[model samples]
Target: MTRPPAKAPAKTLAPVVLIDLAVLLLAGGGLAWLVLRAQATLPYHWDWSVLPQFLAYTAEDGSWRAGRILTGVAATVRLSLWAGALALVIGTCAGLMRVSQRLFWRLCGGAYVLFVRNTPPLVLIFLFSYFLSGQLISTLGLDAAVAGLPEAQRPLAEALFGPLRQMPGFLTAILTLALIEGAYMAEIVRAGVQSVEQGQWDAAYALGFSRRQTLIRVVLPQAFRRMLPPLTGQFVSTVKDSAIVSVISIPELTFQAQELVSATYRSFEVWTLVLVLYLALNLPCSLAARWLELRLQRSDRGA
Candidate 1:
């Protein structure tokens, strides 16, 4: 007979920790008191009045549209979507190469993962922007192409990637984010693939499936299911990590936040609102990841 899972420790799932509830409350209250005292002493003028203006404004065309804050949010979502998709593609390919039988492929994958994961993202962005993207954009005349894009397509293009003028910088950010995220996602994919039973592999081989066919048809399906939780976590991570590209002035949330602070001198207010916006964007992703993890756990128990 199989052994049953041990009962979880009551403390682990307990809603309230009565053991130190008073101490916890006292500490929390003390922190809040300290913050209120500091704010009182600070010379900063907190103007929340300008916040609504930044959230929505009337354009020169007399059409009401999103202001800097919402525009930044849109830019962030667009950057994350494009970068995350490319990262998934790069990660899947590199991850499969990691588990390949061929020595050369394994070496290539290892080198890629080693190089990217070891390098700091700040360094990666600067290096890629100056060395790679600059060359490609200038050589391909992407700016001219963007500028020459028909007016009919301009609205869609702007919606997807901000203004045409910003396209070169935006593309660079997308490339860098995808490359950085891909290295980590590769390991997730590898671990998920390896989680499958060796017996399953042997059974597939017994049925005359080629290596590629087995991986594609059988292993991938199960592995992808297992990968869903971590994949969603990585997707969240990508959205958060997109903030790092602000150094390159890609006009994502952080960059726009900086711009607003400069214009309004409401550092605390701007950053607090940014915190809220980031929470709004990432909280759903986190909840979805949690649900996926729980679902996977339930499936495992059933199996």
Candidate 2:
């Protein structure tokens, strides 16, 4: 047993390392070429320095504070957070309805999915903004209540819901995002729930579990493990789709970027920064999903 001529670690890794380095170099070269080509024809001067001011600035007292871009990012994150939460709730319910034994519940879920999935998201945003949200706010007297809040409490309301003037718009955006994303989320949930072995249901029933108990205790847990990856993906999609609300002037990231571009005349730089900001926002969700998936896989193997 001569150790098979001592397998060299460097020899084994060299090809992979070389390939990775080659890819990086090619990407860098392509980016450089594109930049050079753009700079040649585009007369606008790049001013990356101004971007930081929009993202953060030092006040007169020298205290650092978030600037317009940072504010916009916050708004975007806030919108996505609320929208994602609501979407989950709506989607889970709709998905349950989709898989319900009752014909009426299934039909209701099916109709909702069909209508929302078939309609354009932008159109939904507008209709909800104008008709549904407006009526709800008026019926609920939300605007009046917000307006009448004590001066001290007004800031709290603004912080929670956005500028009082735009509260309706913000709520509208959230509803639209939830309804639209919920349609897709329902399908994901339905599929995940359905993917479980039918024997699992039989086993739960054999254990004298009621349907609801079986679903809540036995089915959903496993389905949830299966659903985590796609749920994370839908949340990421929610973040990106939140940008569309900018068209209705919600002052989210894209809206703020547009404002910055108009004022700074730095379309390329502003958009590039905005693009990076979005990637920064979404990349963590993607990574976390993968980590969770791996953890689940390990747990399954261990069991």
Candidate 3:
């Protein structure tokens, strides 16, 4: 005998979805009201047409080249990528030191986190730009070396380092961002490491694994799974913080936006476009992190 038709799963809106929709609607309404109020009070005229030219333009050869805003975005992405990699290295070392059995290592790690975490990022940027970068560059003779490179090799050198004139400023920004982000990343790494069960450590020890072997083969693997979400968050934070480098004239997105505003006197439109650009960068990251977290949780449950 044929079975009766199977029932379809019920379709229902999630509470979180409902809440998000409500929040978005309210935010849109509020923004509309604010814009209307500003239009009545301010003498400013909004011309969005000029904004596209700042993002891209056709060169004399008819090939499209990145304009001011796109150039700024590229710079920001490059800075964030370099800074994030450096921060990961610093964070991992500091995290391992924080969890080390050696007294000196622990003290060193603690001191780094304490000092960096306590300091404001802006102050660090200025201090590094003025003092650390200049001394380090001059002592290393980086400027002279770059200046002496052959024409063919200069492009490679600039790609490896940065623009010749802005090398010090760029390096200072990267170092400052890495160190600041490293402190927060250190704590996240530390927590992830410690979250591993004590039973796992005991089991590894019983199985004749050395301290190093157990951490490398056992603890870190599990800790990394847990660390993915927070690590993704820290990377996003690095992207946002890279904007601070613009204060020292690193020519990142915010800096380019500022230049555009000065030239066009279209502060509101320019800033709104920049705000959306940041959201474009960050929203994907946030969604991906959530998806990864959920997938990991499901795998754990299935296992």
Candidate 4:
């Protein structure tokens, strides 16, 4: 006898995903409308002669290249990359210290995190830029050393600083971003480390593993895997936070965009360009984080 026809599996549609997509599209369309409306509502007619020049950032005379916007974007990326690296190192150490058995170590780690986390990040950025960096460079004679460097060595300095020859400003911005991000990253690392079972430690110890060996061989490997998602998100946050350094005239995207608007008096046009620039840089990173999370999940499941 022939079997009855088998039914195909039903595809379940997730309502939450549809809702999220609707919200995102609505927000995007609303923002676009607002930008266009603002551009139309400008009080006076903007001179269209400079519009092409501003957009192109080059003049026929080969003298008026307004490439500071590009420079600012590059500077922002550099700051974020350095800060993210520093924060990862600092946060990992602090997190380990926080969970250590020694009371003094824990206290020190706790104090650092508490102070950084409790204070506003912007205040920290301002204080460090003006006060701490000012003192350090002066007291350490770093400025003098850089100034007194051989003419031949100036290229090395330039490579490190780019056009920013000022020692205090760049270092202050980097350290400030790192310090603020590190506090949050420390908690992330601590939680990831602690999430592993205590029995795993006991097993490693029984296998004659030293504390360091246990961490390297077993604990850290697992902890790192668990931390990847949040770590990726933190990296994107670092990129976004680098824009805050613009407050110090660090020549980041927002700063240059503001300058462009001041010069052109086309606030909407300048801001729209900057908004697109940021989306270009950040959207890829956000997508990368999502991809990494999925790959990691698949790897975890396979193992």
Task: Give the number of the best model, judged by TM-score.
Answer: 2
Q: Give the TM-score of candidate 2.
A: 0.91
Clashing pairs in 2: none
Please list the C-alpha lDDT of all candidates, in the order they appear: 0.91, 0.91, 0.89, 0.82
Error of 4 at 136 (Å): 0.9
In model 3, where do residues sit more than 4 Å from their true spots? 1-24, 150-162
| Model 3 lDDT per residue over 1-303, tens place | 999999999877798799999999999999999989998998888788988898999999999998888888878887888899999999999999999999999999999999999988888888887876778878888767767878998787577655777776777788889999999999889999999999999999999999999999999999999999899999999999999988888988999999988888989888998999988888898899999889989999999
Candidate 1, residues 1-303, lDDT tens digits: the string is 999999987666344566478779899999999878878998977777888877898889999998889989999999999999999999999999999999999999889999999999999999999965679888888888999999999999998888888999999999989999999999999998899888878999999998899899889988988899789989999999999999988888899899999987899888988999999999998898788778878988999
Can you write out model 2's per-residue Cα lDDT over 1-303, one digit (the tens) per residue? 556676666557888999999999999999999999888888778777877888899999999998888989989988999999999999999999999999999999999999999999899888888875669888988778777889998888788878888887788888888989999999999999999999999999999999999999999999999999899999999999999998888999999998988887888888999999999999999999999899999999999
Q: Is candidate 2 or candidate 4 better by lDDT?
A: 2
Residue 101 of candidate 2: its Cα lDDT?
A: 100
| RMSD list, candidates in order | 4.4, 3.2, 4.0, 3.6
Report lDDT (Cα) of residue 164, candidate 4: 34
Q: Candidate 4 residues 101-167, lDDT tens each?
A: 8999999999999999999888888898877667877898777777788988888766666553655
TM-score of candidate 4 to 2 decimals: 0.83
- Provide the lDDT at 302 for model 2: 100
Q: Candidate 2 at 109: error in angstroms?
A: 0.4
- Any runs in candidate 1 off by more than 4 Å, and if so which? 1-31, 59-63, 295-303
**What's model 3's TM-score?**
0.88
Pairs that collide, model 3: none
